[model samples]
Target chain A: MSDREVGGAAEAAAAVIPGSRAMLAVIARSLSPLHGQVTVPQFRILVILADSNVALRSGDLAKALDVHPSTLVRMADRLVARGLIRRSENSASRRETLIELEPAGLDVVRTVTRRRQRDLRRILERMTSGERAAFVDAMQSFTRAAAADADADLTSFGL
Target chain B: MSDREVGGAAEAAAAVIPGSRAMLAVIARSLSPLHGQVTVPQFRILVILADSNVALRSGDLAKALDVHPSTLVRMADRLVARGLIRRSENSASRRETLIELEPAGLDVVRTVTRRRQRDLRRILERMTSGERAAFVDAMQSFTRAAAADADADLTSFGL
Candidate 1:
């Protein structure tokens, strides 16, 4: 397609599809309380840790976040200083340290998550049950497609 | 509700709703090309400028982005240094400057937008037409609600 056609198509798609920009705006607002307390990446780490049933090794957590080990370590240091996360020597391996969320970190995650859900629930309440069901279905399909694409890309890179 | 109950409700909502985290992960993957070139916030500026028909004054742009004037100024400086955006004297006012996308900036916006659409379309193709319609309807509702919330917050804060 010509550049103009491409631009038009993109605009049209943006109008119909759930633009990430809008989703992000809502999310940012929901997480406003955590603004100065932790950066988004650090908050993400807290969420991951809070959700895990067992402590994760620093390297494993870094891999899960797709961040460099050094970068993860720095973030972990900050979280530790803030008393949001704790790092302990892995009993299974003396050379490795495991990371887990502190009670404060878990509280932060729960607070932000509850606020986010309340915001979403308010939005959802405005829609019909049918609309909600369809949205859930569509989202599941989209999420699967996106995941497949990511897997393909990873495979291509021999990951 | 108890904390556990609240956590359970949030998890249930996350399962049914189009969670912003998933939406963001998809968007980040789609925009991976812009990585190391420009930050996400800078790219957002490019998008806003590209979408607008006329140049936007710094104050207006900052308001549109819900960011501080100083922060916007710093971001504008970085974009200017990168040659992706140009700050020109607003003909209407000598004291204020207007921001517009340069050709390079427009190109970047188009490229990223096209990829984003392609990714979304690939996902959409897997859905039924009814599902697509419902998704659109639900998204429109959610976006409007989110915008209203933001507006109410701004008004409350006298912004």
Candidate 2:
């Protein structure tokens, strides 16, 4: 394709990404049963926590996910409710609540990752190597641009 | 990185796509300057009509976007109010209001596509060719897996 054609396609593809994201949200919702029952956002929080060596406080999780503190509070509440994480007073700070993933949560993450890998493998098998390469490159470019666009105005929205 | 490591990274990267999609939603929201007061959803309807090359009733748009018919009703009402689309009077189907984008709607799509391509260019410039190639491959795999995973009822919530 010519540069103009490529540009047009990129914009056209960008136009579809939102709907694709919504579809992925549905996919994430469907995966809740593979592990112990958990919401996708809650599991995302667990993955972030499990990946970190140190326990994360609620505020840190909120910052990492670019979500409101109240949203993190609600997520933390749900995770705690599900026994996937424990919330208690921080040893170093009285005002902070340190969040730690329990063994069950760790197991859940493993199971979920395995399931996703299997799904990914099947999906990758369908693509030509070149097509796969192009798709990932597009995603990275799209992501970086979106992030820059977002960071340009952090407080523009309430979030 | 090995395939395993690359896959993990892709999964991590995949987590960011939803946030990017949300940013696009924000961009869609910022279309007021071009729209001269059209709603984002109305613009979306226009784009969908323009892209389809065939008249689509409000119900089809709602279903395609996973929104409610009433939402489509409201959006259709706004588009018709602005004279960017006219509801066809159908003798065969009185209930179905077939929609076609007007010349004004076409102008809006052209402007939106241009702005989006500029954002796309900014993103593509940030990556090395090799990195871009690998990233694109990874994304294609990730999206393919994600779509299949959804179809297979596999949720990534555990990870």
Candidate 3:
């Protein structure tokens, strides 16, 4: 890209930051109820389990989180202590254990999700119908491009 | 709010998450070049100084970052060691020291910001003109509501 073109792009991109931070702030606030009970990484574990209803192999969970297997075990120990997750020997493999989200884990995830939705609703309902329609359209298009870029590999171009 | 109303809002709110994550991912990738060289919190210090232009009092910087004064001192000491920032005693006040972003610090922030903007432009340009217009409008409206919600204090209603 030409320097001028990159400059123009930079201007357009800067527009998104402040607003994005605000939305992220909103999402974070939704997690406040968990406070000291569940740290962000711990909540991430709950989310992964909540997303996949079936129990995850301990090895697989560590890979998904990009953490060392030992690190995953340490984190899981805390969650188990808090009754947020349970571990069971994998029936398919005697050597493997599966991590399953406990009912309490799911409940906390749902609570956080519901709070997020409420904040979204409160903010979204304030916009005009035209704006909302545009929001949906804009988001669809943006997501499509974002996905393609992600697939292209983000490490390119010194990023 | 009625259950139906909240449910509707939730549906609308859900549309933003995937795209928001995509955008946030892009922003994060822009920071990859700083990996091991400068941590996220350290970059944050650079950004605040870049934004302010002038040097900031050490105590003020600590308060702005919501970190303990001693913690800020340690972080600043590291930055001073790296030559990304410098600390100097306040001439006006015998008690205070000032933290200033060095030219190197400004350069890094610019590089990351420019990378982010380029990604933004690339994504935004792929959209139709109508979609772009809508995106801008949607963001403006959304940001306004976000500001109001922040002012309302997110802790209310269990966040």
Rank by DockQ, highest first.
Answer: 3, 1, 2
For model 2, the stretches where C-alpha displacement exceeds 4 angstroms are A1-43, A103-112, A127-159, B1-55, B65-91, B98-120, B127-159
Against the true structure, whose TM-score is highest? 3
Q: If scored against the real structure, what TM-score would every candidate get?
A: 0.79, 0.51, 0.80
lDDT of 2 by residue, B1-159 (tens): 378655644554354434334344344333535645665556667767777777887787787655799988887788778778877866688977787787877777767665654554455445554544454445545555556545432221111
User: Model 3, range A2-63, lDDT digits (tens) per residue?
Assistant: 67555544555677766655665677567778878998778878877887789999888787
Q: Give the TM-score of candidate 1.
A: 0.79
Q: What share of the true interface contacts does each candidate keep?
A: 0.28, 0.14, 0.54
Native-to-model Cα distance after best TM-score fit, residue B109 in candidate 3, in Å: 2.4
lDDT per residue, candidate 3, B1-159, as tens digits? 567555555667887766655655676667778877898778878887887789999887787666799999899989889999988778899788888988898888888877766767788776655566567667777888777765543322110
Who is ahead in lDDT, 2 or 3?
Answer: 3
Model 3: residues >4 Å from true position, as ranges?
A: A1-11, A150-159, B1-10, B148-159
TM-score of 2: 0.51
Candidate 2 docking DockQ: 0.14
TM-score of chain A of 3: 0.84
Q: What is the interface RMSD of candidate 2, in Å?
A: 7.7
